[model samples]
Target: MLLRLPTSVSEARECLAEGAVPIGGATLLWAEWQRDGFPALAMSLRGVPQANALGPGTLGAAVVLHRIDDRVPDVLRLAAAGVGTGAVRRTATVGGNLVGSTLRCLLPAALALEARAAVLGPDGVQETDLAEVTAKRPLLLDLRWRDPVASAYIKLPADPGGRPPVTVAVALHADTPGHRRLRVAVRDGYEVVEGAAPCDDNIENALRTLRGTALGDLPETAWDAVDAQVGAVLRAAGDG
Candidate 1:
């Protein structure tokens, strides 16, 4: 096994170009190694300044989950704080969570917030929608988004001792004098509902579609919980 710790973004890219797998925190990779063994070459992004940078509306890819404090929006903060456990939070990076094969809480939250990602790829760094970055599984450099009027997140576990199968995030933004824009992102889908207020029927229908198409066949009880949380978030945002 070989490890290369790059101190700058360019250095990191060089290492990556040599076929070294990028590593930050290594929380997910650790699990993979435990099951499937290690990669031949790995580059640590923790030492890269650009990957560790964090500011209002901008989160460097290497920023650990625990570092996502009050500096970010409540929805994002809550979602980060809720990932895995305290130890996992300390070791999981924003980039890892966003690009992980499995659904992580942060993805839905980021999508709901309309966050964009700065990706470092073969062509160089480009800013694109977070969804696109997730699908393409590129090297995420940072994430940026505009401040939202309000946001919320919820996750329901598949079982008492299992990962959550249903995760939802909602962001509310002021659009017109008497209306608001609602962005709802589920574990595997996203929907936008614009009106004077969030319509229950429309949101429910969207969730149903998501459950059927992307999220698999979730039980009605799970949908009920999602409905309850969505309502609570809307109320907190002064819409309900």
Candidate 2:
């Protein structure tokens, strides 16, 4: 197998003209490689400085999972901290985590961040919502989001060692009400409710629903914890 390690984005772009696969943490790709055998050509982003760029809005694809905890939004850090063990955090890349876990803790945070993603491939680059990138997809280059007043991520069942069954990400801009800006992923899928982060009204509304309601369906074991978590974040932001 031949691997091309490019130190710059332009160089990396220049390579894989014939469609060599790109590898960041190799967390997901490594599994496929083991199952289907190695590809003829692979591009490694480990040497690419541009692949680890981090700023208020831009983050490179090769940034490791652990590093993001301190660098990213508060909620994003919570999600990052929940992903596996220390060694996994050290080796896993943000780009990998973005596409690896189905019931990912990061998805809600990314949504709350309103993150946009750039895909780098033989087609040059294309930008889209971070939530649009599926686990089956590849070639992510970077993620960017505008700064908000407050953002947070939290999970249910209180397990930091494994993926949670439900996760919520909340974002409140200075101009926006903190109680209303929330997006939640029930499993691998989620929706941004039309209004509010969920409170009395939401719970009451759920009681009126016929079936399949989020509030109605919330597991008894996790509801109180979820409520408290959301409350704490809002209170920290002085919204409560």
Question: Which has the greatest TM-score?
Answer: 1
The worst-scoring run of ten residues by lDDT in candidate 1 lies at 188-197
What are the runs in model 2 whose C-alpha is more than 4 Å off?
Answer: 101-103, 158-164, 175-180, 183-226
lDDT of 1 by residue, 1-240 (tens): 799988987887798899998777888788788799889999877887778877778888999999998888777998898888899899889988888646556887787678888888777788898758867898888888887777777766567655445676777666556555666666632322211234333656544554554334444655575567567766786657
Tell me the spans in candidate 1 whose CA falls farther than 4 Å from its real position.
34-37, 161-163, 175-179, 188-223
Instruction: Write one digit per residue (lDDT tens) for candidate 2, span 92-211.
Output: 887777765444456667766778888776667788766468634657788888765666666555455544456666665443453434433333224322113443235334323412
Task: Supply the TM-score for candidate 1.
Answer: 0.79
Q: Judge candidate 2 against the unseen true structure and give its global Cα lDDT, from 0 to 1.
A: 0.64
Report lDDT (CA) for all predictions. Answer: 0.73, 0.64
For each candidate in turn, the TM-score is 0.79, 0.76
